[model samples]
Target: MASKRPQSPPISLVELRKRCRDASLSEQELTDYFLPDEENSKPFAPALKLNEALVDVGRARPGPDAISKLYADATRAQTPLPKKPRVLTQTFRRAAKTKLLAEGDSWFNLPDYIYPKTAIDFLGSDNDFDVSNIALWGDELEAMVRAKQYRQPLRSGLFGHFLFSGGGNDVLGSIPAYVKPRKSGDTDPAHAADYVKATFPQKISQMMGFYRSLANDARDATAGRVVLYVHGYANAIPKKGGHYLGGPFETLGFDPVAHAPLCRAIVAQMVKLFNDALQSFAQSTAHVVYNDLRPAMTERDWYRDEIHPNESGARKIARIFAESVRANTPGV
Candidate 1:
């Protein structure tokens, strides 16, 4: 009989990191073995409490059923009574103070740290302004709108300022195709521009629809008192390519050394396209402000990986956003 094959021991986190650095294991393999299936696959939640809150409200749908039963009972009664005049009294109270509501993807989600602190610290350490974040990891613009997540907090009419960060994932999702290797001697710029021209219109329209709906909802809920702020992404080094996180680009299944330049160029163009679209949308929409963080972010050592910013970077973004809010909103 053949001897039984020896089973390999489980890989520790340390071993995993070492293998990732050595390029001995792919990110997908690591994720499959170490991470929960849901974590690896499900889209991130908008807010910690959003799902629970939705469930709580969902249970209240039976309220109308009770009202219908009451109507049925009233119809069975045959007696009539004289009606009494109703007294009316009016009580007035101050309007609730406005708060900031943030929504978007991982940039605002900040997996490793307390994200709201970045914005809250800049707004005021004393907590003068309330801030709520509903960002999720791996969220696309269309998904958020389709889920109706944007309308949830706005429905309360309590938010006075809106902070949004998105479109990064949309671009990232298309990166593999966007940076696909072309034939030898093909002009990179022309090829990239052609891709952008063909793909960006439909993408931009989808993004615009999200913005328009958000703007219209804010106006309806807050009577146009809410201010919307959107920021552009900073440039990143393509050579790194998610190395810190053991991301797909770590292996890339291609010649990384040869393709690095084209990848970088494609990233730059993608950022520009998204930012230009955001600027144009902001220009056309009322009460919308676009902050071009590219110049500052490009200079700052803020990125933790190819896609995410470290604490320092987050703080800088918060400061810029806070300044914009303070300037536009009358009494900060």
Candidate 2:
């Protein structure tokens, strides 16, 4: 009997770039794959298009004809009770139920093929909340705010909460650009601040401004009642296991093994800067809650890779979020 060849998994936009690079897929093929759709035509990666559709489902309002019929029925004679009262009551009841609108990076948007689980996946299963997760893999906070893809859903007045998980990609994903190659005769410092590029601080400040804008928008959209829940990443120990992020460190002349301490410090600094900003925002801003995820997933066993947490870890993070929602929000 002949031996069978090993099978490869299906392809998707999440890792299309890697496959294209390895197989030398042509530009025309990519064009054919994503063209004819206006959102997909944007200059960014193709994966964002998928997220845009997933999260930007506009108001599900009745059509003009349906409205006319409903109006006629409500005003018609011989009708003991008008349908308007019942309809309004139902709408109000639904509006009172907790609905969540989420946007962020890979932690909230990891593909099902890789781990079949994410924080949102677990959170959605919780009884108290209904989640509209629009997170995309490799998304940065700057891009998420600039896109304002959640604006439509937010203004629809259907959601009572906004969940955010960002900043990690803004710092960690851009490591190759933000981290500088060490100089000769330079002793390794206790922190990696000296190794980081000057622009990193400016970038973080800009992201904070965007975050404030988003929170204010959510508040204004819902008449100051929208609760924004934001979470920060746990400190991940850098390892050469995942398909993403780690390669760039080595390419920039920073060896994972030789510069292990510096790598750890870089990640630690990134987490601190991000989490601190989130905590400050939570304390200062109205209707905002920050959940520090570090304490929950401090051990290496909590992680599935260098960056993302495993299923058990995601469950713990989800539990933290659910508890916050239960304690803070008025109704489920």
Candidate 3:
């Protein structure tokens, strides 16, 4: 019998940790550690929400009427924006049909099928069918396939999917400032500030862009609603977590010269970016969720360095997001 192989999460956050521990990486350097090397990588799961809503990308097809409705819905969504999901007024079923054919058998390989539409259309609200207004945004089905691929490896069935790889952050440096120290942690605030100022925004922006791509991809592929759940900062994992991983953001207390309000300000910026960038997906019933993690972050449990969390801590954050989407989100 073939030996049973161990599987990895769509995101092997643990593997990311190990690589970081052995090496001293810059914010950008550590980020590269998490990205997908699709050519040599194994398959895994797509992001969480994708698996639930749009499961089968290849075999699924929308009826002709559904395509028209999606266009109409998109139109009304862009204009004065529909506060609720009402029927769209204007529609063009014939032209919509012609556009779908442009993709040929699968449109799977087209880049346009998965990027933001610059803006969402509200005029074609009457289009309740599957096709989008211009057939630009497309992903849900493809996302699911990609997500599963990332969860593991290709041989195991998850290699080509989209993976979360934001050029890494300065967690090694930041965790100490906001978090109280354990034993004798590094009291270097400037190091933390540098991490926050230099690295945080880039990662947040990168992640948001990834989500936008997926959202468009979902619309094109499934012609349905998309949602985002905000899973923000947590209390540190006591000690060693940040130090162990070597990220710059791991809290190390305040340093007189290098420290500033950079950590607080950067986290604030991340929240704004997630909210404002995502707000454009209006018209479509997308939602953003926020919450303070349970078991609360503590100064002690954050690894030995007073930053980063053990698997347990990371789970709490992931859970807030995972549970909310499961609980809310209509017909998801």
Candidate closest to the true structure, highest lDDT:
2
**lDDT by residue for model 3 (77-163), tens:** 112211223344456323331011001001111111121121111111223212122222222223433453222221221111111
lDDT of 3 at 251: 41
lDDT of 1: 0.54
Best by TM-score: 2
Q: Candidate 1, clashing residue pairs?
A: none
lDDT of 2 by residue, 1-332 (tens): 99974333334443543433354434333333222222321111113122222222244433333322222222220112111222357546755435777788767865343233777888988776777777765567778878887777777776777888777767655677688876654436475877788887778787889889889778877888778999878777666532334566667666666677787787677767878888898899999999988888865434434677888888888898888887877643
Off by over 4 Å in 2: 1-97, 183-189, 241-243, 299-305
Backbone N/Cα/C clashes per model: 0, 0, 102
Query: Which 10 residues in a row give candidate 2 its minimum summed lDDT?
Result: 75-84
1-332 per-residue lDDT for model 1 (tens digits): 99975433455444433453454543334323231222223222212111221123333332322322222122211112122223434431222233677777766653222222233334433234556666645566777766766565766656668887777665644555444444555435445554344555567667778877767877776788788888767665454445421234344342334555555565667777778888998999999999987776653444434555555666777778877877887644
Model 3, C-alpha of 329: deviation from truth (Å): 5.3
Greater lDDT among 2 and 3 belongs to: 2
Q: All candidates' lDDT scores?
A: 0.54, 0.64, 0.30
TM-score of each: 0.62, 0.67, 0.32
